[model samples]
Target chain A: MNFYDGLTFPAAGVIPFEHHRAHTPLYYGIQFNTSGTLRVRINRGREHTLTGPVCFITHPGAFFEYSLAPGERHDFTFFCFAGPRVQEYLRSGLLDLTPMPAAISREHKFVETLRELLRQRELGNYPESVNLLESLLIQLRRQTQISAFLYQTPRLQELVHELRAHPERDWDFEKEAGRLSISTQHFRRIFRRHTGNSPQHYLIQLRLAQAANRLAHSEKPIGMIAAEVGFEDVFYFSHLFRKYYGIPPKKYREEFFV
Target chain B: MNFYDGLTFPAAGVIPFEHHRAHTPLYYGIQFNTSGTLRVRINRGREHTLTGPVCFITHPGAFFEYSLAPGERHDFTFFCFAGPRVQEYLRSGLLDLTPMPAAISREHKFVETLRELLRQRELGNYPESVNLLESLLIQLRRQTQISAFLYQTPRLQELVHELRAHPERDWDFEKEAGRLSISTQHFRRIFRRHTGNSPQHYLIQLRLAQAANRLAHSEKPIGMIAAEVGFEDVFYFSHLFRKYYGIPPKKYREEFFV
Candidate 1:
């Protein structure tokens, strides 16, 4: 079935005190809890609490229900897919997902991914949207530890994961390879093959990504942020950041945080 | 800057053979040709031809150039995002995307996702649109082997993938759960907990979804489609299809396919 025929992306927002009653089997939903606490139930199932930075999946015809905890205002974003596949998945027990992205970092990633998905959809990139929905499912599963591996050398993947987890780490090719029990020469070759970039280049990119995230989302000082991302010389960091990002770090942060 | 601040979902359609000459940096573009062929160039870069079901990203400030391939009628969808993030990503080589989703299936998914994005935007779901755009980038990166995964138990995710990919499969719980090295009883329990439905119910939904898609997209006979989607009894399929879709199979086809 063409996935588009029955698909729907309802405006995402808050639902007040009253809960949504059970409806017919029609749409599948991914709901992210953005604020406060959301309490949900499927049919006569036990109540589940959805804290901030968490998400849950709902199948069609599941007698679904949701509401904010008493005295709390609820905020959420939902992406709904309608059609037989959703129903089928629901019936097969594949549509049952709950409270995803248990960690703060992963939750942030999930929210960012959803934001991009919405952007593409708004631009009329239908095919890209479908791919993104698939992407989102995979991301959720990765958090669940279901083995969603990037097609890279295991050692390189491990290094990249670490870099993402802790961008402040002083990472070098020799050090990374040693930690992975591999030779530096082999590591460089495989890393380039998988990432299409030299190890140093990849590390720089990771650090910049971290910096960008921080500059946009936090009130940290630019020099402090540079140091946090492992730039010993704030001047060099600003120069490289300007050269690569098309603007000085201070300007970039001003454009976003201001 | 907010990604949405300078974004524009240009009306999706076509641009004539008159080439778009490069000018001062303004918008970033992700264009998909749904039909015919389009030829484009960045600055004096090599000519790139975009055929049906093809996509390309053009950065700002590269003296962008494009035209229809000789003797071809070009129809396309263009998603233009402006502002500093686009420029920054471009300079950093993060936005140098070209002819993405080379595979037909993936290309189709990308288009569908974009359509939904547009729908949300038209409804003034600005926040949702932003989220979806972020999602699309993640999806594209995942496809590039940067990573993508599905959230759910492996066995269940696989089954759902199969149903989505080939809904006509003669799916049954006993057979499917067995294929996953599990017992029917355990499978049923788990499936309900996850999906809130029995396995048999899910397969029926898949068949119906397939039928709906075929009815909307093809000129096939209702009976043929019913059988094709695993309904041995045409009358029964028609009845069930009508109950779910609020229209008879023949009428539904006429309303959509015609």
Candidate 2:
């Protein structure tokens, strides 16, 4: 279906080159340097020197440009997906397709995951390939947004971990901000910057994600699940679920029920 | 590169079908009867009705035939491998390819493992897919030998589990046989029949498998790993390891060091 394709970096010798595509689909590339350097140019952005592991994503219809210094070398694997869901994911900010590339240290798990997606394609297992590709997008989203500043803010990280682990907790932004010794406004601003969502919105997404998981994997009643994820009113929960997921909770469960 | 291929069962009304080829690859199929029955015939063997979850293996160059009753429905998934390692695995008795189809009760974990393999294939993730497939073979080996009589024999089951969990223990056949109120010769015979290996041989394989896993995953010294898996003589351990795996422990570690 041309949904995705992948491979380990080839062993060809490096030569200076440029690739430009005017109307490319969503492009995802992960490159790592054992040693040496790689330079990348995205849309009219300046040539960025990438050392260690680098991840770059380009939105649909965006121009992509690439180059390598003469005799310089790097290893990379890539996947490109073009479909309606890709556009929806981009619009919803579940996938970041900003032209800027981000560099991080080599993440073994991330590389292994990409290779797994490639392996699935080799086996002609298309359905599973797309499933893992969406998950890879989730991982890449987290990686791109995580910065050194976020690491310095341990309290915010702790708060996020707590919220995800115990979504049923009745969270209050003011109280949480007070516990972190930050004003509620400052807390919301920084949380949004790091996670691309305000604290309240992130919490709602977390609660809905958990509820969806439980519905698909467990036989819990809809009302019980609503209550379990901190919903006081089942109708309100259902309404919010429909708003975010398009389909209501019951239909979503039936669609993904193992 | 055609090491393996897999598929979930297709939904279709049944008719008499015969599948024959001059030289077929090794075949493994796990079918679950979510609704109806499936009947299979292997190389002139009497028709076998598989009503529940059933697993069957076919050796290379074997004639295989299958059918389902009219108006009946069934679900099945299968894998086939054509590689040198598969031949070695079959010779070592790690994968049983006896012609008779064996009907087994639904094993939730087994079904989940195959689904995981299918997921890996769908992702075009060949390396991880093969890795999971080998582990699946190991699982099927255990399941195939576990007869109803063995299930009724809790003591025997416990013994096998203990040996697997703690291969480092110094086990003597006579002593364990006495514990189970059986003669040493009888114990050896039943254990061989149930596990496709004598107790001593089975323990050796279990210890070696553990050692291989540790070598690939941990930085422990060869001598330490040998002793940890109940080998007082490292030299003897290395010899057996080379004989079984066609490489010394150190070489095997280097080959699979990740």
Candidate 3:
């Protein structure tokens, strides 16, 4: 059987509380979706509370139930894909994903795009809608892993927070690493393991990313951006920007912004 | 070497188009934006005009060139992955895909979402962006065959155009296959082959998509939507609507109607 081929749910009128609890042979348990305050108790005796956006995957033979809060608007879309992949991830303990930067920057444009996609799906484009949902899911997973990696190392987390907080500052210094909990060498090693970049390298990537965004979305002059992102020398900043992005800062601005 | 480990493309002032083209390699090239135009030429010594969206895969050694028109803006996104699987797809001739519906639609959403993700990547969100991009590429390829099973047939093109011109009339008791120079059976097979559904099904899907747009973007009523799409019986229209979409006409109005 195709995935989600013969499945749908009642979304008629005000769906005060809609929950799917199936005991199907292929994949045990009916998938559930309801609006407003679904106090769900899984087989593990964990009471899951959903205030805004909440999603959880219930495996085979898992017992679940939900209740809604009066006048609290809640809506849901969900399904189960039966496969060994889920089992493999579980067995390998790889399902333990941490939060992603997008999630951390929850109010950022990234998550808003996702929420918009979800809202579009809820409007029911089905075939096209499912594609968007899958993209959101893929993004959600990636975000979780990012969060996991950042949370894995203290130095990495502090450095990332620092980068976000002060993107314009030139950051090729060991003082920032010293502020974190480890020796500079140890911090660099762990940071690279989790984020695949040394402190200086990661900082440059951050600055470039910020520079790219500015280049794409803003019309700020190269000199101004150089100063804004903490490069004191205009020529050096221009050189680094070009070397990092392959195009001179001004050209990137025209191509993307124009 | 890491996929983007240390690869740099630094250049001088606003990234020059020449520099942008020279440095970045086109790994998987496909256009998903329909109704857009692309002016491009490749190593084959051919000047090409592309309408609608297509995915283009240019090999490493292949000479590549493309530009979007001034007024005919193209909204598209792509990922560059150099791994065993991508190479496998290239060699398998499987990636030489036609714009089958499932894949095409998925590719549109995939690119749209990816553009946003890439935009936000400079926010120090590497792990998240990378992860989403990875699964997004997978979604793009998988949607191809699925879409092939679901798009409208070419035989219905003229009839659809006629219907759209005056959809208020009851368009029935007419067979278009004969006019299209094919047996009805063959036409249907080819139609489904190209469009992923029977001629009638395609008509309904089109009407539904149109109806959805009207309801969501305009203040059109159910009766008008039914009439506009050639459905005379309001009750029967609602029945078909619920049967295919799992909700009553009113709910579609409530959820999507502006």
Best by DockQ: 3
Each prediction's number of clashing residue pairs: 50, 13, 49
Residues B1-258 of candidate 3: C-alpha lDDT, one tens digit per residue: 032232222211222222113223423433334446655566645666656655554444556666655565445444343434444444543344333223245445666656655554534445445445444444554455444433434435556457555545554423567676567788777655443456677667556646655655667677988887778888887888776554677765564332
Candidates' C-alpha lDDT: 0.59, 0.61, 0.51
Model 1, span A53-153: residue lDDT tens: 66767655567677766566655666666554444444533334544333223666578778877776554344456556655764554444322223334
Error of 2 at B59 (Å): 38
Quote the lDDT for B2 in model 1.
22
Candidate 2 structure quality by residue, lDDT tens digits, A1-258? 121222221111111222222333322333333334556666666777766666666444555565544565545455544545555565666666563566655467567667777775543344445555655665565566565436546778777878778878999989988988888888888887665567888788778867877886799899999999999899999999887665689886764454
Query: Order of all candidates by lDDT, from best down to worst?
Result: 2, 1, 3
Can you list each candidate's DockQ?
Answer: 0.02, 0.02, 0.09
Which scores better on TM-score, 2 or 3? 3
TM-score of chain B of 2: 0.55
Cα displacement (angstroms), candidate 3, residue A111, comes to 10
Q: Candidate 2 at residue A123, lDDT?
A: 38
| Tens digit of per-residue lDDT, candidate 1, span B1-258 | 121343433222234443344443334555666666666666677887656666666555467666655566655555555554454444543344543333223666577667766665544333345445555554454344211122224667567666657667667778877887778887786665443346777667668867876886788888899999989999999888876665688775653342
Q: State, as a TM-score between 0 and 1, how close model 1 is to the true structure.
A: 0.31
